[model samples]
Target: MSDDDLSEKVGYGHPPKKNRFPKGTSGNPKGRPKASKNVANAVELELDSKVTVIENGRKLKLSRGEVIAKTLVTKAMKGDLRAFDAVTKLLPKRFREPLAEANKSEPLDPYEAEVLERYISRRIAKEDSHD
Candidate 1:
């Protein structure tokens, strides 16, 4: 039966008031947890160490604290700031500071970072292939 029929069958004369969240309010108070914010933050692993090193000498330290990042795939595809910022993943931590501080140090030359660039390109291409 419809709501009206159910109301009639209940014989309460009127139906109970419906409930809903307030406008612009989220039901989840804690909100969603974030990804890693900085590369230095530490995280916990159930069995093993939480730290994980990526390609080359790049290392990515996880964080239990909140972050301000979206998914890496989207960042790569959009070529957003994070995409450019992510080149730190190729070099060691010590190299990153010096490179950024260098007078003539070149930015991550997408063409020069062949292996990583190609890998990203292939992944993106594959993702797009289905569409």
Candidate 2:
């Protein structure tokens, strides 16, 4: 046998061209199904589904996301610190804080002003206590 044929016979990593996979075919044709949705898509579908919830002794139907948000807010209001953090995280960035504008002079509403004052005071107190 020629050295080329001998090397092909004992090739370490390279498979013979003829016996290798065809140009377009996948190595794992039976692998994960093409229609399988990813985690985010699955979660979104789940959250979009409606569920029954009780509010003020009245049964109401709401999306899973709404139910979850309500539950998180209720827990946070009841002093669950982790839930508070989760609720904050779930809020849109703009809702969490006012967007900065260089030229806009939009006045803060009473609630917004109160919240801002409380936030600033807490931050200042925290900084003072750290010193």
Candidate 3:
């Protein structure tokens, strides 16, 4: 069919010429604002900003991202299971493997060991009673 014929047949997918957008005009005249940043870009900028952090009883300046990462690792080290999993997932595979190995070889703190012993004894007693 001729271009004229195709243009004339306007029902569902097409609009009549009078209703169509003008040749030199845009559908969105102002377009996206120049000041707007997408979510990823905004997050990156925020994470890269520097902030004060306290470590080893000293206040130090660090990037916000670094502070967050240190907090996650500290929470993991304090026996927070969810934090441990989150830190493991966030680390590079090579770093995660070494950390896992070190954790396995390292002895638990005295309090942690005592807690584990109590938990095990209680679990055993509960199972024995059930049986």
Considering every candidate listed, which one attains the maximal lDDT?
A: 3
lDDT tens string, model 1, 1-131? 57775654333554343544567978797888898666344332332344453535766664322122334545666776556567457547898878768756666676779978898899889879988
- Colliding residue pairs in candidate 1: none
TM-score for model 3?
0.47
The models' CA-based lDDT, in order, is 0.58, 0.86, 0.88
TM-score of every model versus the real structure: 0.19, 0.46, 0.47
Judged by whole-model lDDT over C-alpha atoms, candidate 1 comes out at 0.58
* Candidate 1: count of backbone clashes, pairs at least 3 residues apart or interchain: 0
Instruction: Please give, for residues 1-131, the per-residue lDDT of candidate 2 as tens digits.
Output: 56877667536777776778999998999987678678999999999999998899999999999998888999999988789889878779787675334336778999999999999899889879999
Off by over 4 Å in 2: 1-36, 98-131
> What C-alpha lDDT does candidate 3 achieve relative to the native structure?
0.88
Question: Worst 10-residue stretch by lDDT in candidate 2?
Answer: 95-104
Candidate 2 TM-score, true structure as reference: 0.46
